[model samples]
Target: MLADYIHFMKDDFWFIVPALWFIGYACKRTPFIPDWLIVWILLCIGVLASCFFYGWSVRAIADGVIATGIAVFSHQIVKQTSARDQIE
Candidate 1:
């Protein structure tokens, strides 16, 4: 059973690589947008990634990583924005 699942993932590894990379890039480019918007965008990405990769299943690890990435990305934006606001 586990081997079957592993095989499925191996076949889809190519798709997952690009998807994860794009998520990282989007997080990096969050400065041009609002914090709330970034949160929503990340949530959408998480949902889509879950649906695509897991179908009707739940993925704790993937979801956690996605949420953590969004939180870290948004934290940096908030820090930079606060600094800019203080300067102004």
Candidate 2:
């Protein structure tokens, strides 16, 4: 089971590249938007594409949602850490 999961991840990881491309395009198309939420959206897109390629529809959707939430949480954490570091 673990080997199967490893193989799936290895094969479907390329989907993330296209997802990042989409995010870049979105940023290029709308230069005025400074919203960092786009990062979470992009990761969700990546997760969807990964799921479509891997044949795990339910897991992919749920993971994508979870990934988005994590992205947001991580983003804020990074921002806070950077601000704190800059003050020191």
The top-ranked prediction according to TM-score is 2
TM-score, cand. 2: 0.46
Cα displacement (angstroms), candidate 1, residue 16, comes to 7.0
Q: Candidate 1 versus the native: TM-score?
A: 0.37
Candidate 2: clashing pairs of residues: none
TM-score of every candidate relative to the true structure: 0.37, 0.46
What is the RMSD, in Å, between candidate 1 and the native fold over all Cα?
9.4
Angstrom error of the Cα, residue 78, model 2: value is 1.1
Candidate maximizing lDDT: 2
- Give me the runs in candidate 1 sitting further than 4 Å from their true place: 1-33, 60-88
Q: Mind giving the per-residue lDDT tens digits that candidate 1 earns over 1-88?
A: 2233343332443344345446656766778776456555655665566566656455633553454454445556667978996876
Clashes of 1: 0
